[model samples]
Target: MTERIVVVGAALLDGGRLLAARRSAPPELAGRWELPGGKVEKGEAPEAALVRELREELGVEAETVERVPGEWPLRSPYILQVWTARLRPGSPAARPLQDHDALRWLTPDDIWDVDWLDQDVPAVRETLTRFPTETR
Candidate 1:
């Protein structure tokens, strides 16, 4: 089976907290936490997809700082392209859209508490370690 390419963004907020969204659709994986992003459309750049997905899923605009360099293939058949981003100026309220049910800000240790899609768990774990929380 061909792998699906999905784009996800790692958004950090005040106090070094990361943003995670809950999946609300596709019965099988409903309620699972994941990074905010969606499938990359045909011929679309992953970075562009990340920006679009954030705007569509969360009511905020973001710019990609860099691609989280690595691939985590999930058992669910998705090969995710993860990117790191910082929220844009202005406080925008985020409402669930598409397959998401809710959103939360989490620290590294708190990340594992949420139910995540099988393939996403590894990425989350790796990211938490790679991007340790910075004291501000």
Candidate 2:
């Protein structure tokens, strides 16, 4: 069996708005929306990986808030783990600096508006448990 790879995703929240990123590379996933994050490098803590990914992929400094409760499988040998995170004080607003071409801050009321990548659907649904549907 192939070794398992853990992909970390951030359910990045601010003022009751969640940040969603639109994929811009890899034609198969281009134009699809998903939480912004990347793989956890070997030997790196998942939280650290998440923070690094947010910086690399979104150009913002952030901190992990809490881990979402469950794990979801991606393609073979890969599994998804999500964490709730918030931008550090004074951090730049998120931007599509890398693999993403667009960024949207979606309030709970309209979070469903974006067309999310299929593998992200369930993990996002699980995030609803942490994010109240009503904006604060």
| Alpha-carbon RMSD, each predicted model | 2.5, 1.3
Per residue, candidate 1 scores C-alpha lDDT tens digits across 52-133 of 8888888778878766668877556567767778777784866787788888888766777888777777666666655644
TM-score of each: 0.83, 0.95
- Kindly report which residue stretches of model 1 are placed more than 4 angstroms away from their true locations once superposed: 1-6, 9-14, 75-77, 130-136
Measured by TM-score, the strongest candidate is: 2
Q: Give lDDT tens digits, candidate 2, residues 1-136.
A: 8998999999998888889999999899999999999998999999999999999998899999899988889988899999999999999989899999999999878989999998889888888777755652
Candidate 2, residue 12: lDDT: 96
The CA-based lDDT of model 2 is what? 0.91
What's the CA error at residue 106 for candidate 2, in Å? 0.4
Model 2 lDDT at residue 52: 99
